[model samples]
Target: MAKNTVQFQQGFSLQEFISQYGSEGQCHQALFQWRWPDGFKCPKCGHVRYCSLKSRKLLQCNRRRSQISVTAGTIFDSTKLPLTTWFLAIYLVTQSKVSVSALSMKRTLGVSYNTALLMKHKIQQVIKERDDSKPIASYIIQLDGAYWGGKKRDGRRGRGTTGKLPFVAAVSTDDQGHPIEMRFSQVRAFSKDAIIEWATQHLCIGDEVVSDGLNCFNGLDEAGFDHRVIITGGGPESVKMAEFKWVNTIIGNVKRSLHGTFHAISKKHFSRYLAGFCYRFNRRFDLRQLLPRFSFVDLRTPPIPQRILKVAELCG
Candidate 1:
């Protein structure tokens, strides 16, 4: 009801995206404006005045005569692809419930699989970095540790399965129980020290953290968070309890969406995929703003080379 209000509803349409970012010039204009809201300035000399080269689309600092391309220092660095192509990639990434895989990107964007994979990784890294720069703080955060991946032939089961990844899912709600913010993060494990480290990074002082009774979560309080552990004892009925209704629902949705969409994702790449899910969910209420906001974030992110992306950690 309240979420259906104009302020919280999604208003951005495909037509709107096309009109705003249809051409290379249009996307470049938006990037130029976002990259330098006050006008072009040399990163080297910090000069406000500059001259633009129409032939090469480069800018020169008036004071030091330093030259800078529109994407020199930003995420688009060294990119030979057109701005429209990048903008379309950003749009597809942001405007989906599940993620746009490399295969999907190749089909949709008309690129090779390798090129699509590179583009997807680059954009995913941008979203991950952007979310990492901000902290989530709310009155109430419903948290739970979850595992992903199929069973192993080693006969290990459940959370202890050999190939699974341990991720912490948290959804913050208002006093009335309406969901507000969410943070889904992949952790090294669900140990006490891990939870403590997570709390220190993602939460603020006095924020209440709600969780099913797990001993590992006990460390959150020691890290200065106001922790509340609700012991449901392990049972199917208890799992259906209203105390963690939204948290449970979100976890189910995340699992289903990921499993249903991708054929199979590598273990190390789980963090990036999870980051994409969180990025879309966290911005769900800001439907119309997702594309432009994500574009701006991409502009702020440093260009992530393939080798660097391969070694980057999503959680750390």
Candidate 2:
């Protein structure tokens, strides 16, 4: 009957965001501090002394004379949009409980649909890169597999169904079974080999992994995890099982959130979209810090151009 503190907590307000990063100058200053907290240092030579090239908005190294723009090499590189637009985009993406579609972003940011989509993907790339680097290491972990995409008219359904994308969803819980950290990985298939590979990279050795009795999950034990199998056979009842409660709930939320927000998700970019949800979920404890934290990571993330974003396949 008690209120959930996390749900009720004060988040970063639009007024506050505007006060902090209302102008291009404010965004540039914040980016500068995030990129170089100590002071200006040449990226090429690591020299401490630098002079500003106000004429072109670049910083020149005193020793090497090499010039670099504050946005160079970051996710903002070569962007024709103002830093204010980028900052507002970050605010909308990070602060939204569910995800924001590019169409909505286009209307809000007043940019072309393609440009909005590019910005969304580029920001999601930063989030995906940041979250993908932090693997889950916990004592009690709930694991489950879920599929994305619409249902087909064909008789095919469930695992191995045509047009469905298989992904592994996991949530690390506390002793009382409160979900903490989470992970969502898009795998080629939910086969034994695929499960093993994903477990090796995202899960830690000796962690307790509780999952449904899917044969492919047998790979968890082989991969050095203390695997606990719960055979809650199909239908709605399986999702109600206590042992897999958190994982199932998270998977449900992800499916509903993504399906409700975006009209379509490309096969090549599914991982990044999944990563965006995981990133926000893992950091949900502090809504107030989400924007600044995301901004920091965005500044450090390498540039992802339209060409790279258009790649046919992902490394996943």
Candidate 3:
């Protein structure tokens, strides 16, 4: 008999993670591979030859003699933390079914709360950037909009709460009804224009989009997708409909995970947090691949200070 496998199920264990990436040398070697798969070419002069300056722990391009640290120009650039700590953080965030909180990370990594918080945000941002370039193509996408953190003292629900941030969720499932990919983003609001832009950016022609008959979703009219609007008329019965199975389940699980993990997340950085969930869920089939996947992205992604992450989100 075949047992059901949940999204978080994977073979990578804690002992395996520690054994594979326990030391600074191990992590450094991994980063070196991710950074230069073919061979080391100087970013400045493109020279293949390089020599390590042991005192400064730098790789100097033989031709230009430019010094490049292993962390140079990467997400870990200008960090005093060891590569092992960063690698452990990546493992913690990617492996957990429920997200890990900054405070919990502080305790786990033995770092200060502020440092843990910064590291968490940095990794989430990398996840966001990695998923940003992926769009739904040739698949039936379940579309829904959700509000987070809008619990009010008056016990009001759904739309127009001071604390709520609006986000749209989309999931692509296989013929057998298993989720394969997910796209989520925090938006200013659920309006026609907003949905139009989202559809254009994240959706493609062969993709069929299914959304609850929210009038705003009509924006997809010219989005070049075969779109269907199913209005369940707002009730448990409607939500139970098979048409919405994957999307509804995903939203429920994500909300629950967020609630269980963090004490509270502000609206500005909500998109990054959502990305963390989306990244994990979208790649759920092979959770063991997450560490290497994230390491590659971190190696490729541009560096940004903690200040820039907040400012960029706020400005957007």
Model 3, runs deviating above 4 Å: 5-10, 151-156, 159-163, 310-316
Model 2, 147-237: lDDT tens digits are 8875556754455466678999999998888888889989988889999999988888878999989889999988888999988878888
Ranking of candidates on lDDT, top first: 2, 3, 1
In order, candidate lDDTs are 0.79, 0.85, 0.81
**TM-scores for all predictions:** 0.90, 0.93, 0.92
Give the better candidate number (1 or 2) by lDDT: 2
Among these predictions, the greatest lDDT belongs to 2
Please, what are the lDDT tens digits per residue for candidate 3 over residues 1-316? 5565853365689899989899877888788888899989888888899998878768998887889998887778888898888888888889887788887888999987777777888888889888887685435788898888775568865544565798998988777766778888888788888988888778886777888988888888766678898888987787677878888898888888887777667776889888888888777778889999898888888886667565333311
- State the TM-score for model 2: 0.93
* Candidate 1 clashes between residue pairs 3 or more apart in a chain or in different chains: none
1 against 2, candidate with superior TM-score: 2
**Candidate 1 per-residue lDDT over residues 1-316, each given as its tens digit:** 4565735565677788899999978987888888878877678987799887778878888898888888875667787788787788888888876787777887888877766777777778788888777777476888888888767677643455554788988888888888877788899888999988887888887888888878899898778778888998866676687768887899888888887778677776787888898898888877778877877777677777666655233221
Better of 2 and 3 by lDDT: 2
lDDT of 2: 0.85
TM-score quality measure for candidate 1: 0.90
User: Higher-lDDT candidate among 1 and 3?
Assistant: 3
